[model samples]
Target: MGELVERVDERDRVLGVVDRAEAERRRWMHRIATTICRDPIGRILVLRRAEQHARFPGHYDVMVGGAVNVGESYEDAAARELAEELGADVPVRFMFKFLCLDGVGPVWFGVHEAVISQPLVPDASEIAWNAWLTELELREVVDRWPFVPGGREALRRYLVSGNEPARPRSAERSPRPAAMPPG
Candidate 1:
């Protein structure tokens, strides 16, 4: 997670800018992150971030997520994160990318998803708790808790787009956009 940050536009698309200059010049250089959503008992898997994390500690996140490396693709990062954080081995499908232009701080939240193939055993070091949330329950949680701050917006966009996760595929590459570079 060395510096080499990324820059993006309002759509979270790469803006071909460097993170160091963005910060030194007071510009937004997005930090690439891979977000994963899962079907936990036919509901979305929700995880509470560990209190030890540097940002948004102890808050609720949709599922597995982490920063992207300087040269890694978002899909690979998401897939690795799923296994590293939850001991999951299912295929990771691509979702949409989220740009927090409002933060004036560049932190590109690259999103992905994978269906649950087996029971998840989330790593206690990275996550604190887990829950399965129906759409209604998700709405309530989004409305009530500050899940990712603009998480409600992200969820809404994801729901409206109807982007479904791809089943396990060992060879086929997902059409999902790649943002972060895998380590």
Candidate 2:
């Protein structure tokens, strides 16, 4: 059986549940939880997706997270994804949530962060490798390396808002620089 996920609307209200494939095919909004694993000194963990993965194969991803499963809360999914992708179970603090629109579709992403000093065991099937990069180092590669669009968006949002929620605000936001090409 295919994985089941909740279909949601722009406001994050669940419209219904459907197979993951179907949800993707129809371009429905869905829930996703992404986590930023930070080191004690403040560098963020990044993962490279396996080369054979269906989406964003071989691209660098800022967070270790995935679709929120049926009946699962975003926090639970974030923790589950952290363990499944990197074999770490450190406590995560909720940062903020945002709606992302990329080539694939729309997905609401919950951003969380955790500080860990433990070694990570990457799941070979899900992540090819992992590294901890400082914000400056990440910026150097942001445009040079191929990253999951949603991941880039989330990262940009996080950076712009200074770790706060990136929701639209009455205050005008400064225009952002163009992103590096997707490798």
lDDT of 1 by residue, 16-110 (tens): 64644445357565555555565643456777778896657777767576656556787877888888998888887677776654433445667
Q: Model 1 residue 18 lDDT?
A: 66
lDDT of 2 by residue, 131-173 (tens): 7666766777777778888888888887877773323333322
Q: For each candidate, what TM-score against the reference?
A: 0.72, 0.86
RMSD of each: 9.8, 7.2
Model 2, 90: alpha-carbon shift in Å? 0.9
In model 1, what is the error at residue 84, expressed in angstroms? Answer: 1.5
Off by over 4 Å in 2: 164-183
**Sequence-dependent TM-score of model 2:** 0.86
lDDT of every model, 2 decimals: 0.63, 0.80
Task: Tell me how many residue pairs clash in candidate 1.
Answer: 6
